[model samples]
Target: MAVRHRLIRTSPRSVWAVLADGTRYAEWVVGTASSRPVRGHWPELGSAIGFEVRLGPVSLSNETVVRRCEPGEALELEAKAGPLGTARISIELRPWGDQCLVLVDEHPLRGAGGTLHNVAVEALIQIRHRTMLARLAKICETEAAEAEQRRPLGQVVSPHPDEGGPRA
Candidate 1:
């Protein structure tokens, strides 16, 4: 099993927003080059997203299915990496002050990765998790910063600028 955690300087809703967007997978998930919704609605149980993992001239076709979702709380996924088999990944979000603590737990469920699971592989997974979590944090922080910019003075405005707010 590979487990890792990261503290994001943003709300759980912000982190979950990133997770909920299937197109953003490549932005945070290491090795993923691109992603697209494949079936149902992403982050909903039974929904899936297709992604490409590129390494040099090699590209692996993959897909991940949502196994569980708890809105701002947690999300569980099952990733299918073709010949590498599949992996079960669970992400939990806890509110910490004004920020969020995210935990990722992963383990191989089948195929070559499962057959060869060991300390060495676990170490590699740890590295991947470290990088992945960092990427997620960066994205969420950037999103928070951008959100701040959109609504200056920390005032929440109508998402649609066309709608006036309380007669200015």
Candidate 2:
């Protein structure tokens, strides 16, 4: 198994918002050239997203299904990589001060990838996780900053509904 973590300078809710959007999969997921919802509602258990990977003249397609979800807390998925097999990916978010600490754990579950899993493959997964987490952090932080910029200087918007309305 390969596990990696990153500190996103934003709330877990902010990070979850990005993860919950199926269309945004390619934005932060490394190697995914394009993606779309293929079944059910994304981020919900049993929901799936179909994505394509382009490598110069070659293009390959695959799908990822949500196995478990805990709203803003956790999401576990099974990513099917054609004949190479499927992998289990688990993402967990923890509150850290005003930011969120995201942890990703991945391992091959079936197929050729599973049969060939070794140290080199683990290293590659680690590298991919590092870049993937960085992309996620950049997205969450950038969006949070942009949202703050759009609000009035003296205005305050509550992240939760029960907190009250946007106030100035």
Candidate 3:
């Protein structure tokens, strides 16, 4: 498994807003070039999103289903990547002061990816997770900034009061 965490300068609700949007799936998920809603409602258990991956001139479509959701706390998904098989991706949101600590855990579940899982594969997944988490943070920050701008003056934006410091 590959696991990584990022400190998002936003509330968990703000972070979850992005995760709940099916259109934004490709924006932060590694390897996906585009995403669209496929079945059920996004972020709900059993909901699915269709994603396209482009490699040079070749493109492939993959489907991902939401396996579990815990509102602002957690989301787990299973993605089927054609010949490469499937992977389980889980995201956990922890309150850190006034901000959110987002943790991502990913592992291969089926097909060649599961069969060939190793240190090298884990290293690659780590790299992907690093990029994905950074992207997620960026998206959350942008949304948070927009949300702050929309708030009335003197309003406490985040639910957590101590969100101004770095997260562990």
Pick out the ten consecutive residues of candidate 1 with the lowest summed lDDT. Answer: 159-168
The digit string of per-residue lDDT tens for model 2 on 68-148 reads 999999999999999999999999999898789999999999999999999999999999999999999999999999999
- Per-model TM-score versus the true fold: 0.90, 0.95, 0.90
TM-score of 3: 0.90
Model 1 root-mean-square deviation: 4.1
If ranked by TM-score, best first, what sequence of candidates would result? 2, 3, 1
Error (Å) of candidate 1 at residue 165 is 14
TM-score-better candidate, 2 vs 3: 2
- Model 3 lDDT per residue over 1-168, tens place: 899999999888789989999999889988999999999999899999999999999999989999999998999999998999999999999989878999999999999999999999899999999999899999899877886687777665435445753222
Q: For each candidate, how many residue pairs have backbone atoms clashing (under 3 Å)?
A: 0, 0, 4
Candidate 3 wrongly placed segments (more than 4 Å): 154-168
Best by lDDT: 2
What are the per-model C-alpha RMSD values against the true structure? 4.1, 1.4, 4.8
